[model samples]
Target: MEIAIIKYNAGNTQSVLFALQRLGYKAVVTDDKKILSNADKVIFPGVGNAGAAMQSLQLTGLDKLIPALTQPVLGVCVGMQLLCNYSEEANTNCLGIINTSVKKFVSATKKIPHMGWNTIYNFNSILLDGVKQHEFVYYVHSYYAALCNASIATTDYILPYSAMLQQDNFYGVQFHAEKSAKAGDKILLNFLQLT
Candidate 1:
């Protein structure tokens, strides 16, 4: 199957490419509208500032191209945050595929960036197939999407936030499934098998 990784100016593209390669899938990393639209599956992975990233996407016209994709689209980390309605990262607006906003972790005792491994509580999703409930997943982010109506899974560091989101053909994950272990691989495989 053809998998396209949306190549914007954001970071973390190489790691995701490597992960897909490890899964025996050679994914194409591109920003062309036609290439992205024609893919069987699309993965949006980013690790960078929201405002700047959004600006870059807008510059390349990918900001509009991504949400219009008809195939199963997956967003990881910051890519997931950008799929929401808005983000407080830079008081920025985002693709409104999911009606949620990104918020900074309010922790006086813990830490700001919710790093390391955390358990993801699965509710119900095709992406969670073969993955156990409350499975541990790797995360590294300061902002999080609040658990809204579209939330398919939840995780907690300072408080419970959306670990996974789903709306129609669009799917998003706050944690890095590419970094998470076997559970992560299962999640990717599940997304790849989406029909």
Candidate 2:
């Protein structure tokens, strides 16, 4: 199947490409609207500042093109945050595919950027199919999407937040599945097999 990785100014696309390669899938990284829309699956992965990333998406018109995708679309890291309604990262507006807002991690002792591996709990989605609850995933973000009706999985840093979100064909994960090891691979494979 053809998988298109939305190419923007965001980092981490290469790692995602590598991960897909490991899964025996060849994915193209492009900003072309037709290429993205026609793909069997689309993956939006990012690891950068929210405001600047949005600007990049706007430049390529990908900001508008992504939400219009009919097939299964997976958003990773900041890519996931962008799928929400808005983010406090830079007081920026987002795609609004999911009715949620991103907020900074409020911590009195722990650091702002909740870096390193963390366990994701309360899993309940097709993406989590074959993946156990409380599975450890790699995460590196300061801001997180709040738990809402669309939330499929939740994680805790200072409090419980939406770790994974599912709304129809749209799916998003706060952690970097490309870097999350075996469980991450299963999640991607599950998405790939979605009807």
Candidate 3:
């Protein structure tokens, strides 16, 4: 399979690549528009500021290219936030693929950057095929896509938020599937199996 991991200023592409390698799949990391467009599946993985990541995508015209992709596209962490119409982070406008907004976790008691393992449930799509209800997945983010019509999976930290989102051929995961171990692997494998 021709899988492509979208390379941007945001980090964590290596981890995603490594995970895919473990799954017996090889993926090319590139920001080149043509290379991304031709891939059978595209993984947009990020672990950085939303504004900066969007800036990098904009610089290479990937901001425009990404939303128009016809093939299946997967976004991880900040990559998922970028799929939204806007984000509270840096007051940035996002890819607008998913009909939702990314917001900061407002909890006076709970910690910021809701890190560590959390359970995800309410699987509403094929993306969570083998991932059982309340399965643990690694997460490290303060911002989250709100519970919207596109939310296929839900996770609770400060509140119930989108653990996974799907809109047409686009999919987004708030958790870091690469670091989530077996459950994460299943989610990644399921995404790859998508036609």
- Write down the TM-score of every candidate: 0.98, 0.98, 0.98
Residue 32 in candidate 1 has what lDDT?
78
Give the number of the best model, judged by TM-score.
Answer: 3
User: lDDT per residue, candidate 1, 1-195, as tens digits?
Assistant: 889999988858898898888988899988878889999999999897998889999999888888888899999999999999999999989998899899888877997688999998857798897888888999999999999999999997888999999999999989999999999999988998899
Error of 1 at 142 (Å): 0.2
lDDT by residue for model 3 over 34-149, one digit each (tens)? Answer: 98999999999988899998898889899999999999999999999999999999999999999999999998899998999999999999888877899999999989999999
In the range 1-195, model 2's lDDT, one tens digit per residue, is 889998888857899999998988899999889999999999998888889999999988888888889999999999999999999988989999999999999878998799999988887897898888998998999999999999999999999999999888999999999989999999988988888
lDDT comparing candidate 2 with the true structure:
0.91
TM-score of 1: 0.98
lDDT (C-alpha, whole model) for all candidates = 0.91, 0.91, 0.93
What is residue 146's positional error in candidate 1, in angstroms?
Answer: 0.3
Q: Is candidate 1 or candidate 2 better by lDDT?
A: 2
Q: By lDDT, is 1 or 3 better?
A: 3
> Looking at model 2, which ten-residue stretch has the lowest summed lDDT?
5-14
Number of colliding residue pairs in each model: 0, 0, 0
